[model samples]
Target: MLRYVIDVVEMLDTPKTSGASLAEFLRSQGAENAEIMVKTIEGEEGLSTDFVRVFIPGSRGKSSGGSAPTLGIIGRLGGAGARPERIGFVSDGDGCAAALSAAAKLLNMSAQGDVLPGDVIITTHVTGWAPTEPHDPVPFMGSPVDMETMNDFEVEAEMDAIVSIDTTKGNRTINHRGIAISPTVKSGYILRPSEDLVSVTETVTGVNAVVFPLATQDITPYGNDLHHVNSILQPAVATDAPVVGVAITTAVPVAGCATGASHATDIELASRFAIETAKYFGAGQISFYDADQFAHLVSLYGEATHLQTLGRTK
Candidate 1:
């Protein structure tokens, strides 16, 4: 619901906020099982900020020997805003908002005795101010920390699959409202769209789901002097699990650091989609890809997981 989106935005729009207090806020919302931790790593750019980890252990609890698969919902963003230059929360923060809102909804559902079958871990940082970087189409939000640090904090081994949500407004390739789902990415190959995810999208939106195309460079590690479609695929490089991008798109390209660009309704739609996906994933009703098929592909063409790393030095 839009109320959830608005609630998260109001909480994180403070002058100097951190994940510690934000975690407390979620606790007050009945996410008593949620865990929060902050990580800070300095990059060469001399910019540093806290990267937050919020883990909401499901009813079966992965650590408790739950057979159900664990689903990781990562809020991918550069920063919420750029401080004085960009006063309020920017478009990039949509991922953080959507992830939190979905967590809140799930927790509320659990409170009502409809807990998910598997574990759901939600992670993202709450940086009120972040740096901006220049790109080909438009300026992008530069992370306060580095990409390696982010992946280290966000991607966990317990996660069997990942839904990397990011604001993809800075591209003209996808000119639509609401959100779009990228094809499933596992190991290193960009495989066909996951039929399960596509069905979930259609059932939720009541419209044929849109797929945003991905280039090879898009899935590569950041800071390689290569252009990325967006950071939606960044998590793929850090995990062996299958990763899919949940894009918050618009009809026209929008800068990630642009202020006054966040739309609550659009965010609500994306959040709901994430929540639904988590539900199915935890229930084992959906699979990122058929394990048998993926293994066959690997046998035919060899391993593509190396693409998930920095690759061999020349």
Candidate 2:
């Protein structure tokens, strides 16, 4: 995990990194059995970015004819770098780095006999010249595309549950210098943390679980007039399947575009956690949320799908 993190960070700490380059790197790392796709998407004001999607199939996973659940691992980030403004890989790139590292590790495992039981879909964007935006405590690395465009590309229909990993250090939410997770979010409802997921976190980190603070606005669609902690939970707005956020955090607020602030060990920790989660989640050993309770919530109250949209005009 650490090796992959170091390699990815080194590769991405450039002004020429693109999705195609990262896809090639994965292929070189024994991804022959996986289905990988790279698309260059252009959004807002001629801004363009590369998106990479990798599907690592499980023996009994949906990619085949089996019925095992598929887990989506998304390296949710605004951009990997600020380019001319900031010269190196920013803190925001941690999510993409950790996620791609997990994909690489899984490919290595597949090269051996450690195949999982379910399919895993991993996606993230690569952008080196993203812009910056002013925020409260620190500035954010703005993406080349909007949240909706990211959702369209990264959020796959085959994903039964999603683990959205993003750098959550730009806010004063969780004051930890490691990884934290958000509760299971589905259909606009912020459910409790999955005990199974929490256990996985504990097993990987060898420490108590740290839950990232979240608000309703955080899970809502971006572009709305609301204060989101960050885009960590934005994937929830794009899928009915339960989504959990794995946040790379810091004890103090840090700008998303801040250079020389990324910790490979922490990113490696998050990568290990995601890989373990995929192993357990694909085997049907755990769930993202309680199905019965979620049904009851829907039965007790109507759908909160409205919260997923931008809502009616003011």
Candidate 3:
């Protein structure tokens, strides 16, 4: 059995959804004995609010009762304009789907806390991969390479929520760019240098938006990439945290490959790696963002700042 901790932050005004509701949602889905707590302060500088704490049990198989894990939730309310700009929740499970389910439910409930119509909901998941074996080089032939499934997990968010995710997994080599000509194309040929480009790209074609981390360093230092980047983004992506994207400029690379050394000759030494970077950088918490909503936030804040400056001058 795995343990999970969930933290919920309320960013909007009005009686938004509470952590208790989210816990209840999970319970309805066959989750057992979710613990809940609420923190409220009156006449606070911000709006009056409540913080709910909840704990949820991990998914294994249903059993009668054996000290099931508890879910915790905390809610806080402040002044009208004091609503939290973002809310977050974290859950752990045996596989990805279980973790994702908890996160998706929390975000969906939070987004609809006030139960307002037309409220936008978005969701996405980021996957991290650690190479368990050395990289194997294969000739660029039109042949299908068998991939051993290291780990497979899924997180289900609201059906309508838009998802933007970044996956941290081992890299694959493909023969598409260019090839050199020689008397014996297979034996005497020059191989072009492979570029290590890591950036957020589209995944899942057209389901909201998905970001693929494809830069070399993003997967470099083996353990570093996985530990730092994925660790930070995991909760946010899994729980549908509100933000644009994580700023990973100052993150350092770590040592260790997912796959071992000397396993495959074709695989590059620095080709695939995963590592843990840091706990927190900015705001002390990693931020997750929906592609469209984040853009709207930027525009709204930009205009608000301009108006405030103009009013001061007038």
The model with the greatest lDDT is 2
Clashes of each: 1, 0, 57
* RMSD of candidates 1 onward, in order: 1.6, 0.9, 23.3
lDDT of 3 at 143: 6
What is candidate 2's TM-score against the reference? 0.98
Model 1 alpha-carbon drift over 4 Å, by segment: 39-47
Model 3 ranges off by over 4 Å: 1-16, 57-101, 104-314
TM-score of 1: 0.95
Q: All candidates' lDDT scores?
A: 0.84, 0.91, 0.21
* Alpha carbon RMSD to native, model 2: 0.9
User: Candidate 2's error at 277, in angstroms?
Assistant: 0.5
Let me know the TM-score candidate 3 reaches against the reference structure. Answer: 0.21
TM-score of each prediction: 0.95, 0.98, 0.21
**Candidate 2 residue runs with Cα over 4 Å from true position:** none
